[model samples]
Target: MSASNAQQYAETQIQQALVDGLLAEGFFDKVETEWFSAQEAESLIGQLPEYHQLVSDSAQRLWRWHYDAKAGLALVMLLRPGVTQAWEKVPGSRVLQQRQQGQALAWEALTPQRLIRAVYQGMNALTDTLDADELTAGQQVFLDALAVSEWQTASSVDHRVDTQRLLERSPAEFFAIMEQWASLLDRPYHPTAKAKEGMDEQEYRAYMAEFAQPVGLRWVAIPRERMLCGAGVAEGDQGPVAWVADEGLRQRLDAQLRERGLADSHVAIPVHPWQHQHALPKWLAEDFEAGHCVTLEVSDERWLPTSSLRSMAPVDGSAHYLKLPMAIYSLGASRYLPAVKMLNGDLSARLLHQARAKDTRLVEGLHLCDEGKWWAYMPPEATLFDEAPRHLSAMVRSYPQALLDDPSYRLIPMAALGTPLPEGGHHFFDDWLAQRGEAITAQTVSTLFGELCECFFDINLRMFRLGMLAEVHGQNAVLVWKDGRCDGLLLRDHDSLRIAVSRLEQHGMQDPCYRIKKGHSNTLYHDDLEALLFWMQTLAIQVNLSAIIDTLAGHYEIDAASLWQVMAQAIDTQIEAIPFEDEDRAMLREKLLNAPGWPYKLLIAPIIERAGGPGSMPFGKGETTNPFRQAGCAASHDRKIDTEENVAKESEALERKSLEREAQESVA
Candidate 1:
């Protein structure tokens, strides 16, 4: 990509996030006309080639934002559909200015900082609850996000990887390469998703997963009595720390421990080299001086990073994936590996294992990475929730040994499936199409997408029936491909499994005894089955599957709503096949298929509202028009007009606004 193209792409992304975040936070409801009909647009500015192209394209929509009525400053934006919000901005939009109604309209270039200021002024006029400082802080965050996005866009221009060569590699090799591709889009549609607030350019290139840079592991020796090990590792001699280190490295570690005169009482744990260089001395100075923690000189094993920057895979083809802590902030939260979270993940894994035993389908289809082996440093008076301790821990995520050894099975993270390759325009789907002797047409692509939905929803609904749901976001959910089909699902990062205690007992399962902080909210336990299903809707369907649909739609030139229709059909098929009580079936049908709106998780607004404070995963809630409704599926009950109706209403409003402005100009 050229420098100009990269800059344009980056600005487009930031603009989409700006409008989508406002819409999700109910800012659009405050404006009179938030869209422009084609007639209104052409009547005002004549028919432009780009405007016609945007309307002709099935994936794009033309929207108008009423920036300020008095200033005659309105933004004409081309947008696309988003599962979490009604519309997302597209590239090639222009801002319009007219001093009076009879005056000719002037078109100005759209920029991210300009949009950020407009949003700030709108917020200032909309609410009295927020003071100047809060609003200014929000503005600064948006600016920072824009700068970071520009950097990311410029940095990744040479990422045109070959898809055919990617398909020819071994399963493990392909998986790693896919992870590198996946790193290109972190959280799809998120504004500041790729911003590593702490790292500069050189550090970002050296440490980011997409760069595919080899990172060495730094060793730390803490007293054995103070070290906290997971249940699986505590009793075993051959655990993650042992498995990752070779005999030579182990000998070196032991010698260093003895020279420090603490060999008998201390054990060595691997640390991320960056973390050791930056975070350790800053946070562990007291411990080092008190002889409670010692840094070892031995470093070993070149490890490659996964999409999740903190996680690493051994270059020697080991299945033991290492997850370490880093001091950088992403998504408004520190990427720390606290023991409390690891313990909760262990409990969640145990429950999943129990569910697997109870359901035969899960037994055949559901797979989980073993996350039970971990180690953390705990001082004499320190608790599990301390901030410093979290930055110095590691967990070994072991893939199922059988699956790794099988040449027929390919483990691809769902993120990779959704992310379109820079060169090929599609991920493994093109490869799959070639293998199946099918042309890459709209119908064939939709058929392939339906098969994927069938496999994905099968595993998800089964777990839902068992009264639990994994956080199946794109990053955590791995689709197991066998031969040429999506065979199963493999889930990792199991800390936030949502469950209902009543539903669990009804299914002959027990609670996993999750730990929650004293005053913080308890999100793990849901009293309502609807709450549990929200995770299925938001993460599994909305985030994970919707991303893939968007990529497929763009790559194959198929309408996204057409693919969503396929999703609806697969969901209906699964709902009927899965054995559920009559009431449960009714609830699922009403909530998923018949509902006019689905729960939308607010992303950027919460960060703006947070004003750069520390928080657990930034989250807020709203509702969006159901994608099934947008796909033209019939609802069981009549609620309100669907997306098309909403568009028509906006169209009529735009016409009226235009006429009123003309009348005012005549008076002026």
Candidate 2:
């Protein structure tokens, strides 16, 4: 046959093969029958350019039969091929024979469900041969059809009974198993309950009265096995109080029951009731130790506490009322008590006092509680300057200067935040870095780095004198600016605070002072330095010795070279100031010399060259030294800058000469 005629014949056979395969395997039911038409087959054939030359008349005719068999059936036929002539052109025919042998065993073992899975998998694989959109639609239709059958099957008694059994075992386990089952059938399961637990009748009534004010008695409803049961909060006429049940709690209860070998016995499972049985008064009496509790009283005369500032909403479209006895707690305190109440009365007194002192109507009203707590309420007209920590943290990154200038500004103990220093500082740095990436200029980053280093130097000096250790990190140091100039710095989050035994004894303050005898302790200095390095890296700043010196010089209004001299002198004068041993100092020196982009790369070039010698270095000979080697160079550069001012002068002269020559040539 002529090549053109053979090619034409091959195309016809390939098209026929596709149609035959679809028909043989009943793929028309999986995808639509219309999808396997001549037009679609031509389009698919055009996509397979690699096989064009090889698809001859005889190959096309044989392939037509193969394609007609459907994916699963065609695959089987390709593997077994009853006739020897069918196997003649196929490459790696032995591999197909082996696969066929294994597939035969699998085919025998497959149940109806397994067969369905295989059919779905086979249909999906053929999607590439059809229009992508059409293939997707067809798959969806097939899945929808299968879903109807699955639903019908699930509705049967056996399936329903099995599902109930699974659910009853453990709510969490049951839901997990159901999720797996649904995934197989391409379905989703949505559970409504949030929690599963119930208090006794008395406790329920008491809780309702305490929490739900004004309303006295309320009825509660608990759902079990799709049925809602009335759990009366109080004996009288009350509406139902409902709460979502937690599935996890239910699962735990179920597990506990089984573990205790009491599966057969009735368990007192906790259930959330729908409503409270008693009025607010009765609930308060039982729940609150004090007979009187805080309440929101909004007339034009009432004051709003800062603690309840976030929660208040306007009423009557005119006035807002905040709940009394407003609570506030430090972030660190949250671990001990996740929630805390701020007594409205104490806060109110403080507000009133401040208002009187300022001679302003800042605080509208005040209320005091028996527990020595006060709530001070402010109207909508109240100024934000009254709040300290919240306002400071919120506006610091953007309008840091304003926060610093506020009259209420106070450096509270870092322990007030309730969380440890290092982690909090790290998170703070991350948040700041994310925000600063878009907003900060290179100049600003450089300035911030320098200022931070100076702050650390000052803080370290203070710590040395006091014989105390402080956890210092980017997060710990809050930079406050006013009028485009850094005005204030605050360090906090003091859970990592450490004081030497001698200092603690000398201070002799009983209420706040704590002592630490040094012995393998994770003290503030050790942790803080690590945190400082972390912040430096996160900000993508090089933390080499020169960088540190540059920062200090900028902060103190001295030349970089002069700053290094000063630092060296300071170090010498305060030999006893630092806790690090001589060996540690040497190691630190080596690290500084080798740090990347250390600005004194040429200084370490000789050492690196010496290490390289005649033959090529095992690890890249040129610029890319091991990181440790780089760090050593950086450390050495820093030490040289500190101890030898003349070296810096010489380096500066070379740099100036190079710049001057470049400028003169450019002019010419």
Candidate 3:
């Protein structure tokens, strides 16, 4: 597709995503393709007709903020369907959520505001009493989301279009096409890009793997006094720290240090170019003047950012991946990689490595991406309360050579499983299933899906039972596929590994590095037995598996309930046969399969209650009836639109506002 055609396609897809996202959030009950005449339409908001009621309904219900209503129908063009709703998985939902969606598509033309307003009309769902201050913060959150969205998919339109076109081909042809592309290039990215004003253009384009642009990492070094280092040295004769950059680069860096008469005083570190260019000038100014920090020119070797923006891999070949700190915010948390996390991430990997070494059963499909050495430099006068010197931190992580041995085997990030293919013919997994040489049948999908789900759950449970919990979101959970057949999962990223203190003790493992020493536990955040498993359970079940199930069920018309039965059976198999205690290992299985209202992390609620600064992690909690637990549930696992609940929620807000006004009047 030409750039123009790609933009057109992107506009449509982006619009579709917003509508679908809003629908999922309960903004509208249905979508209508046909537009009503101005006279025939009923009044919506401020005498706007029913045609405008879609936007009006979204706003009045607090599902949308009526920020840019001056432009009428053009507002609809800003969003595209990021993901098609599994109406099959969402009961009481009807949306004309197809290609070239939204009534705005019917419009003959749009103004320049098409991109600007669309991006500005951001989505940040609020579940709190909105005061002036709170409302301002929410708006900022929405704007930040808008800016991030704009930054993401702008340069990848052609790449996305290419993937979309190729997915329609046969499996062999698709495989060939993918081979032409970079490994891991065919990830199904959820289309959420928007054009927003005041958004800085992407500083680095190829940092996005989807772009497949070959780029080099920026390298730098700081002295020992200025830097905090966490290193894991294996049983070898090399230095204490494992460097992630090229060996040649390391040699050159060493030579440079020798030339400067600082050979023993300094060490090299890899840093995100964006951070180095933008953030470090101010943050590292003191260090540079004190002769503690020095920037080194990195030879341009191709690298690609993985699903997590902070981590990057060499495009050609490398034994270790470079994990750098980024200060940007995405997915509810600042993307900064704290030095503490970088160090602990490696230690966490070492712990897991030891576990796998002890039990060969844990070794099969599970490959621990060990992060060994991390380095960070903090500016003078920086305090604990200050945000982490994320701009100055870097870690070296082990790249699994074993998994890369077979060219036929592809390791895909779990989140990519359910996303719509770029250009659009089917979900990513559908194309994946085709590649697996499985006939595209309901039975095949269910059976294979069950296997995948079982593989994921088993790994998660087994980790918890062994006394560690890897925050098992799809980004960290990689699906290993050989010739399209689903094999076991490969887990990566160590920073989020929550170790249970008691369980680790029981397992005969103790590390002073993981303990609290001196002023506050910076690197250590141990979770109790229950909390240890919460991240795994919530992120995997609710966020990852549920998403995949929704897509497979909706897109393939496979029975969600049947899939649930498979999951239940898998859990039962683990429960009945596995040697682990019921309390720890089977906890996830019990909640998802049989318990009422499993503990769910309220992701949005915490974002709503914004506590300023580098504040402690904000998380919320709420419970919904576990769909998996329902007895005699039908063929589908669709969540019903909470009509009564929504009505009550909206009414209570209205009533509360009215009372607030009356109280203010009396005080006046």
Candidate 4:
């Protein structure tokens, strides 16, 4: 791609994020948009190349909104409007602003940085609490994201490796490559999705999963009495050593401990290299001065980062993947490892196991990573929710050994499937098409995607029936493919499990006593089933599958409506097959298929609202037009029309046959 193309693409993503967010968060309602018909904007459409294709139809409209009342207006074309409005190509890509006092407005191309600043200034007018510092910080983040995204897009063109070679290698290698591709596309539809705030360009290339660079662990020694160790963290630093298979590295780490003359009393905790260099010194200065924390220089073990940057897999192939704390902001939340979160993961895992045992479908279709082995530093006075303690913690997420060892089974993160290669094809779907002996047509791809939807929704709905829901978004949910079929789901990062206490009791299970910091809002337990299903509608369907649809439509030139129809059918099938109470089943049907809109997760507004406060994750909710309803209702209406036409044709044929018989009898 040319530099101009790369920059334009990055700016487009930022523009889409801003308009979609503004719409969902109801900013437009505060200051409504002014629209023009295609005929009215004929001259404007002829002048701009971007608007040429969008205004071909008479129904298309051009939208103008005065984000800044003093001088300017943002311009975009409206494609489709529902719960979430879909605009043509790049909304806000071009702005018509006044250049001089009482002068005619001229169109000016807007960069991502300027777009964010204009929107921020516009929003600041409506509210008194909007901070200048926060706006500056947000602008910097947007610029960082734009640069990183441009580099990623340029790199993706030549980054293709042989898919067969990856699959033929060890599971570790195959997963690493898949994750690298997945990392290329971050969370869908977010403004600053690619921003790694703390790292510079060099650190980003070195540390991000897309680069596939081997990362070395930094070991920190904390006295045993001061550390809070989980179940599998063995005594005398053996747990940390066990992650390293090499004997030489193990010996070096042990020697480093002994050389400090505190080997017997201290336990080792692996720290991210970036954290060790920047955050550790600042967060643990007192501990180092008091000799409570020791930083060792013996770094030998090498690992590869997965899509989730904090999680790392051993370079030498193992079931174990390490999760550590890195003090950086991504998606408006600090990526730190807190013990309270880990403990909740343990609790959620137990609940998952119990729910699986009760339902045979879950037993067949759901898999979980072993998040049992974890350790954190807890001083005598600090609580589980303390910020400082979270900076020094680790969790070992291990796959089932049997699943990993089996040659027929493959683990691919759903993000990999959702993110298409920049060179115009998807690696996973191409392989699937070849394996199935089918041609790459829209029908074939839709068929395969339908199967995936069936398996994915089956497991998710089963958990929903049992009053539990996993964060089945692309990153957390891994599709388990066995012998060319999407067989089951493998879930990791089990920290934020949503559940309904009443539903659990109906299935003969009790609540797993979860710990929450005092006075903090509790989002884990929901009183009503709709609250739990909100997660299903947003994360699983909207965020995860919608991204896949976008990629597939763009790559295969298939209509997105067709894919949404397939998904709606799959969801309908599952809701009926799963035996729910009559009332519950009706509710599911109404909310999922018949409802006018589904709950939309507001990503950007919530982050902006936070200004700069610490939290688990930033989220706000709004409603979006139900994609399922849009497709399903259209499909159903089409089928109805077809049936009526067939009946009319049959009646005409019968009438003609009767008339012919009557004429023959009269001649006789």
Candidate 5:
């Protein structure tokens, strides 16, 4: 069919569906038939009395029914698609018979009666506390029953409900009501209370350690429950170190400190001379008795030791820990060191090992602070001497300089070669040349360019392979400039780590494949592709022909453009290469022309322009059909002549022929 005919058919189908839906819901009887047309529909909807409210109600009902039907269909299809057909073949009314069977099952389970009781209970609670204006009687009852049923389902510890369904309710109402109900039932609940305060050094340490013992709490780095204020032990330092567990909770305390911001002022912890042995641990008894922990006597009339109290004012600064509930327990800064080390260590180690194998020395041991900060410690010459390297200071200061001077530091470094030259030192390309000098011949440059291209391709391919994406840019890559040569490169930062498909599968976690198997995954909801695009864009790479080819061919050991043709052939000859289900295969075919692996679609423009025959326009007509057009296109185009000229010319001719046929038809 023609495009116009197809559009008309779709419109007619949609109109019929809409009219049937409206009539079924009793809206058709309320509105005139004249209101069906686009202009008339808008005018009639606007002029009707209480139109906005009526429309809103109608839309809500429609959406609710649609959602219910789809959910029912999905469940039914999962159990047996032929159930609908079997029902149709029954002697009685099909819809009514199905409804009766469903109702009967529901009755056997006492679902309706439970729902009614829940609705009544919720209505009673609502009447006592909520304002009448908040909801009408009917709406209130409906919402209350929904809330109760949903809460019951979600509150079940064994059978987990859909998170999306749980999220449908307002967080404020859900949390408040759930907490209140849980409290009334004396049930264990997740706390949303503020953190506690005024914890002594020993108390704070014990609390932090205890808080971190739980499985879920292992990953948290900062204390969760207590607004702790006191001096405690630093990992290496001997003297009592002042610290705050709850950074945000002690805002008032922080404000006071800022107000009394004396440059050299020191705050002392309150210590009781007549120390209670019971309060002190066995190892700490001697220090406690000697007044090393505090300065005041416990028995002194003027000195009231507020050790048992939850909150207290600081001796000099306004620092204090406020009392909060048990649920607020959070991990301190020290807890996340291991995770930081694991991630950064793995990355740095990989890069360092690769560099070392190639006789490169760009990175050294990666260090993670107790505060979860990462630092790559590059040794001067792989051995520490009596004197520290000058570059140590430069490396320490480089982070600050990179952040401030080069916003693209994180992205550009990983994807490209050469460091950001110091202002006016040399142009990037020139600096790259100057360092390599005579060694950087045309052949070397070409090889380096190819390597850089392959690096990007591999990185992206690894992203897909791992089912993760890295927000790689220049800054994330560190180029070790020794004797004017790039000895090594490093990729850093964990915030950029994303889950790729293979990794998800390896973890035994549910992936997009689950949706595909269940018939829920389709082209319209291609979240995987969307995620890939997000990765590309975030990495500052355009989703153009070259970028697409590079990304798709990243894992292969070949040029991106050449890899595309190979992939196309593999699609035909090697089904395993596609690695998709039947539905995915159908979906992929629909999008084949625009898909990343199709070289015909990717090289059309460059090929056409290179022909320079009849109907060939000048190179810079601003109408180049290639999606990879950019300010650097002319340069890139010229660079490609040596490698890609023949392929590009052929593709361009084919595109021109197709365009001519389309033009001829339009004229006819």
Candidate 6:
């Protein structure tokens, strides 16, 4: 057979296997059949590229994410250039779909290719709104970067003898490998940063955590006045205004900024070396020339890119993490920082920190890594739609150093934990277990797994009850692991957090933002805050914790159903224990634990619908039946059965005792 035909046959086998697997796991929203026309299948086969068994499946070995067919179809058009033209080639193709039990099912093929499109389309859709008719050179560069990044990720996940060397790597190194694995699997999807010009591709991969990239950030300093700054303060500490770099880079930056009259201005912003070189020039050619943005390449600090593409941390084991807006489009939007958000970045986070601080458990267990410091240039009459100003922003985030109170406590992102080691011997969980010398058996692992679920549920519950709702999806949610145990959730990205004004009013908590912005464009919102928060947790659980549970269960032969049950119970337990309650909080509690149905963000579809820009809310929400509520029912049923069994046993024992007493009396 031709290679293409062989590829087609293999692809069908994989899809069928996945369909059967999902069926076996009963992981579907419901057991339903979808009928598809021969035409639709053909169209879909054309649209979705292949998911290879070796590399792509290797990532799925980490977690099986949700599949939305409509989102998939939409994403296919969005990812490649000439969306309309591509469809035109297949003119007869309908808005193709399948019918499951006579009900229409949107067809989403969860191929690595589709995953790539979901991310690229989601992100590029936001940027591509301004461009049309084939890819520009820069846009092509962005796309090329994504493909290469995808290749790096795909190659890395192909765990085999070749990756045996990777086992010798450190936690950071291994986790960074996971970071690359996740980069392609992003919510909006972005490939790893393309290899820098003149840099070896192999070397570039080494610099990225996914590629297990070992590299330092090149820092630059821009004048404060030259950049639009945001750090939430009613006043006081300025936060971090300077762009971050290594010690040597910092020394040089100080001298350069001072020499250039920038330090004198108290207006220097740190920049990522890649952004300064690759993205910045193309994005802000006129602005840089006009001196609206001025930078001094200071020192080179070794920083590792975390799972979140734009966020970077010190590779040299520094405590502070820098969150800079790169000009790259990853996920749904450009990873760039906008002026408005920068102005309010700190406040959004500070609001959550301060409010949650009132609750001791939350304060200790839930770390808010908000730096509140941001600096960026704002050109005169610059609107958000304009790319230059917003992309040139940087913010600093405080590492959850507090979570490190126990020397053995390590702050690992949920993504890192889910990532499989290239070599067969260990993974993130194995590493944690190794530290404590815990035996890896079903009973021990299951017990600890239950604790992990409980930790996640409670941490989210405490924060939500505190009236601080943020988008704590997989990337934002950090696992505070102590020895081999899961400690709590340490979250980053404060500006993404939303506060319920009504709930805050009840608690006498001040609103985080002075101005209210509608939609998810900013943190401040008056209405739907509770609903958004609720959905955010759902997204976090499904994407992060649930994904972890599924992976662990599948990989280790643990009962997937049992793990999910534990997660469900954890959710129920937290809702029952709301410390202080009010109407809004009560409603939130009801919806979380007992509501008939819950809403989940249909993130990719919205990006396609909006063509990637902020359409309605950049966070797309969809309704799903409340699994927690269902889990509650299941738990109740189990309890009732146990109660009945206990009653029967007692009755049987009492009857025997009475007979024995009667026999003894007769003998007397």
Model 6 Cα lDDT, one tens digit per residue, 1-668 = 34444333333322322232222222333422333333434444443343111112111211122223334333221111111011111211111222233333354444433444343433344453543223444444433443444444444344222222333555444434545545433432112322222224454454444544545555444444455555432233332533344556556666876787766554556576667777788888877687656765554556677666567766655456677766544443556777666555567766776766678777667776656656666665776445667767767766655453345565666764454343323445554454657745544455667787778767776766666666666667777766567767777766566667776776667766544344535434646446556545556765566567655654455544455556666666666675745664566557655566666545333333444443123445455555554333353332122323433454455346446646976896
Candidate 4's C-alpha runs over 4 A off are: 1-4, 69-78, 82-105, 125-166, 233-237, 632-668
lDDT of each residue in 515-557, candidate 1, tens digit only: 7878987779999688898888887887888889888766655
Clashes of 3: 11
Count clashing residue pairs in model 1.
0
Q: Give the candidate order by descending TM-score.
A: 1, 4, 3, 6, 5, 2
lDDT of 3 at 289: 71
Return the top candidate by lDDT: 1
Cα misplacement distance, residue 527 of candidate 2 (Å): 14
Residue range 4-62, candidate 2, lDDT tens digits: 44333323222222222223223334442222222334543343343333343332312
Model 5, span 1-668: residue lDDT tens: 34444333323222222222222223223322221322334533343333323443211211111112312310000001010011011111011001123533111111222323332333333456654234445444333322332222222211211222222334222222222211111100101011122233344323321111111101001111111211122232211113322343234333433454511232222222211221223323443354323222112111111211111112222222111112111111000111222333344333323323331111231111111221211222332211111111100001222221232222122322221111111113333444456332233333444444443443344333334444444333333223333333334443234444444454343333211223322221224643444444323332222332332222111234343333333333322342445554454333331332211111112222233211111111111122221111223332232345533554454346446656976997
Of 2 and 6, the candidate ahead on lDDT is 6
- Cα-based lDDT at residue 104, candidate 2: 50
Candidate 4, position 373, lDDT: 86
**TM-scores of the models, in the order given:** 0.90, 0.24, 0.70, 0.89, 0.25, 0.67
Q: For residue 289, what is the lDDT in candidate 1?
A: 89
Evaluate model 5: give its TM-score. Answer: 0.25
Evaluate model 2: give its lDDT: 0.26
Clashes of each: 0, 77, 11, 1, 38, 40
lDDT of 5: 0.26
Q: What lDDT score is found at residue 183 in candidate 6?
A: 45
The superposed Cα distance between candidate 6 and the true structure at residue 56, in angstroms, equals 24
**lDDT comparing candidate 4 with the true structure:** 0.74
Model 4 lDDT per residue over 1-668, tens place: 56666556656655666566666667666766677786776766666666777555565577766766655555444443432343333333354332323545456666556656666666666777765324555445445555554455444333453355555666667787888878877777676676666887678877888777889888888888888876455565565657643788777778888999977888777889999998878887888889998988877457888788999988877887789999987877789998899988888988999989988988988998988788888889999988888899888788887677787788888987887665443457767877778756556777889999999999998899999999989999999988789989999987788889999999998898888888878879899787788998888988899888877766665656667778888988999999888888999998888877788888766665665457765788887777765554443432222323433454454346446656976997
What are the Cα lDDT values of the candidates?
0.75, 0.26, 0.53, 0.74, 0.26, 0.51
